[model samples]
Target chain A: MAITFPVEASHILMFARAVGDPNPVYNPASAPGGVIAPPTFGQAVAQFDPEYHLRPKPGQPWFGSGKTPSGVDKAPSAGGLHAEQHFEYLRPLRPGDVLTVEIKPGATWEKESKRAGKLTFRERIAEYRDQTGELVLIARGVGVTTERPVDQG
Target chain B: MALSASRIKPGDTHSETVVSNLTRTQIVQYAGASGDYNPIHTDEVYTTKAAGYPSVFAHGMLTMGLTGKMLTNYVGDGRLLKFGVRFTNQVWPGDTLVATATVTEVADLVVKLDVVTTNQDGKDVVRGSAEARIDP
Candidate 1:
């Protein structure tokens, strides 16, 4: 699904703070071309994805805990685990730009892991275009689902 | 200031302690800012009891963001053309992370770098590469 992502200066500031980056370019007051977003700031498009499962929506049955240990009876074996992420920037992203994002499935594969049983990896590619439809960034992300939680020891 | 091809060699490196003693609150802050509220990253009850993990962990993107902080600080703002990474290990709370970028190549107006981020235990958590525009 395509989503509209309106990049805002406050959001850039908050993201920069969250990442613990004290760069002047991310500050609206110091940046010459408005506030330039951090490199991973494009990932925040999840906020605009109306159906992003990671976010808890109102009136919906979330998988996270509620009164019970879990709101759902059975958690799926395929859990969300990020394996890889890559971004190619056509230009620096600034607060004034409104982006149109489209995400598509890339590939799926499986592997055996001693630490986490069977691992299923899925790839997703997202393209962000500015208001004028010029490509701004291309992001490729790999997500993994383990049969079991990875062993810490 | 952006790196200059005249000033760097292939083995030249830059390192920074991207984060010291990471906190769960910082993890929560990342989830709120990045809009990825996976329970495994925030909800301790869901993470421990339901997810079968020892504790809520940091998002891979958060680690990438931390590492990117070091990269941008080294390469200068708005200089990156590409950045990529693989999450080799999970980053847990209280982990102090050090990120390093090594110049691998300098050609014309671009520089390629190998990026690695390690935890307090000296284990690589994120490994990747980056390319940035540079000056001659």
Candidate 2:
């Protein structure tokens, strides 16, 4: 699925300041793309996944969908965290650019870990294309869902 | 300034980023800027008193952003094509991080770099690499 949105200088400035980089480069007077977003800005675009587990379901808590407790009581609270991130830019992302992002599932694998045994790794890829339908960037997010801890704290 | 592919060498080293002033304020700003309002990164009370963690930690994306800053400063944003990183360790407030990217290859209009980010005690915090398409 693809989601299209317009890039803005204010978002770039906010993101730059949020990351502690107050360099003048984010200002329109300094660079192309109005406010040339940082290299890693691809992650900030909201993902478009109907089955996104992180999405807050109706009446659900802000952070939880009550899915963890439903998964299995044996499943420890350790859960999983962001394992890796990768981005490929065919062109610079700039303010005022209307881009469409296609989100799709990639490869999945399993690994044996001492802390969380039989960890499962899944990759989500988001391909961003500009208004001209040219591919501008590809961002891959790898999530490693940890197996239930042998010794739950 | 943008670094051209023809100008980079196999052994060229990019400038380094050593951010020692990691504070809760930066984390809060990151949470605000990134729209990643995960309480674990911003709310110290939720993390310490509620979640039972030692303290709030910086977002992984925040660290990745700093690494990008180092690369972009060395070679302007237009030339950067690929950047990737793996979260190796948790970064807590007050821990100084030193990030370095070294040129590994310069061929076919592309420059590859090997990146390593370490904490104050030299513990690896992030390990990854990046590839940028340089202009002639």
Q: Which predicted model would earn the best DockQ?
A: 1
Model 1 Cα lDDT, one tens digit per residue, A67-120: 965788887543869999999999989888999999999999999999999999
Question: Tens digits of per-residue lDDT for model 2 on A1-153?
Answer: 777757788888888877667667787666544567888777777533344443344664554213332222332244456789999888888887889988899999999977567878899999999989999999998977665522223
Each model's DockQ?
0.84, 0.45
> What is the C-alpha lDDT profile of model 2 across B1-136, one tens digit per residue?
7778767788888656557769889887777666665566766655554444577788888888888888887777667888999988778888788788899998887889998788888888788999877778
**Model 2: runs farther than 4 Å from truth?**
A29-33, A47-60, A64-76, A116-118, A147-153, B4-7, B49-52
Sliding window of 10 residues with minimal summed lDDT for model 1 chain B: B37-46
lDDT tens digits, residues B41-106, model 1? Answer: 988888898889988899999999999999999988899999999999999999999999999999
Candidate 1: which docking quality band?
high
The TM-scores of all predictions, comma-separated, are: 0.98, 0.84
The weakest ten consecutive residues by lDDT in model 1 chain A span A69-78
